[model samples]
Target: MSAWHRPSSRRDLFRFAASAAACAALPGLARANQRPEAFTSGEIVENGHRFFGSISRGLAEGLEQANKKWGRPNAYILGQEAGGAFVGGLRYGEGKMFTRNAGQKPVFWQGPSIGLDAGADGDRTMMLVYNLPDVEAIYRRYAGVNGSAYLVGGLGFTALNNEEVVVMPVRAGLGARLGLALSYLKFTPDSTWNPF
Candidate 1:
């Protein structure tokens, strides 16, 4: 056998430990204060939108409407007031870690799992439709009302800023899949364009 390798010195070991701790704290710190005060409508229209594997603004708009039907407490483009619209999108960074596809793996198999996805933007853009009604419908349609929904996780319908809505991410992983199904539900004021 060869001579055992040392970590250079105690100082080096401490440095590694410090670095690991710093890295572990980074994600939680980044997600903190992610909530925004307002977003604009023009930004949604100008920016490219994709939905359910389709690149159609109409569908996205429709989804927004559905979210509203269920009482989307906050809705707007990227720069408008954050309330009124049910669906809201925020800037997201690539390499961000989120539980997206964890259930598929055999090792710990937690059902649809979470993962770190890499893409544009230093922070990942989060699009949340604050509507519980639509979410319930989605669960019924996709996985049947009587039976439990697919492995996609639930945000546990909760109240945010006096509004009942579900949080959803735009990424194409499991979170987005469940959100996509939720988008198919109908919305109130049904104008198709800034109905609220």
Candidate 2:
């Protein structure tokens, strides 16, 4: 062989393959860091119906109606929560947060409430998040208003707002529910029993 020519070996092939793989992954990594664009109401409605089945019809309609006022959401969370209340209430849930341009991230949320509330209810919830600048923006305590009636069919919905981000929680479940309460949800990176 000449000085400028060398036979390619298995080691060289492996190195080339590894380099190509890393290069291909760079775009995905970069995209993961970027904020996602707003998603359509139809997309969220479809997902809700698919996940919750027959009961989701009311929730979908509620979201569609709210979409007229809130516009499209930048992200959404699909999760289930079960909790009971006797004056003071506590709830916990886990789900995946989907962004339009970026991928999904696992999320856990827990919260406490106090007011004229009493119930033992378990519900599947789809939360539409609006004006979210980034995924990390969701990791905060969102304050809930006392008497924002967002109900449809057998399902009920509530709107929780904290400045620019608006979270509309659509729920389908059972139990004697009444009155309103001051509540807040804390979205954490991991599941925790602590509600504070």
Candidate 3:
């Protein structure tokens, strides 16, 4: 009806097409960028029992706290690790990353800590994975803090992150270890003694 209401020129038509294309693509882009569906509390609790052999008070506490703070997880790592901290220390663990979209792959992680910390023992570790876009994305450095140890020794609520991916490790009845440390965990495809 009017010049402003209709495509008046070739340039205007091209711009309109571009806008339409972008709008059409928005949904796919959103789907592509969306992280996988997270694990529910019921699922986590069941898996937690299976992973740790039994659900303890420490495990329950950590899981509840983590779930409340970060929602849920789309992937997870079940493994064992050992380290002792006396002022500074290193931790190493190997496990398999399980994801509905990416299947499962072996993963190894090592981390170093520094603070007024002390203790040592090896324990089974279950890391609840969140914001993981893919399996390969898990292989990166995630910095975290063991700021507190709950219910004696079940440490599971520590948040390790690399801006994009977050791994919340939940360990229960692992050992007689305790301390507070700022740490960075580097995950790799293979095992290495290096903790840097």
Compose the digit string of candidate 2's lDDT tens values, residues 23-43: 999998888767779887678
How well does each candidate superpose onto the true structure, as a TM-score? 0.25, 0.80, 0.75
TM-score of 2: 0.80
Most TM-score-accurate candidate: 2
- Better candidate by lDDT, 1 or 3: 3
List the candidates ranked by TM-score, beginning with the highest: 2, 3, 1
Candidate 1's residue-wise lDDT over 1-196, tens digit each?
7654446889978987897799999875554324322223333334425222233354356446645555332332111011111132222112211111111111100011122221211111233434323212212111101111223321112111223334333322223212211112112211122211
Worst 10 residues of 3 by lDDT: 147-156
Give one digit per residue, the lDDT tens place, for model 3 in 28-59.
66654455667777777777788887555566
The TM-score of candidate 3 is 0.75
Higher-ranked by TM-score: 1 or 2: 2
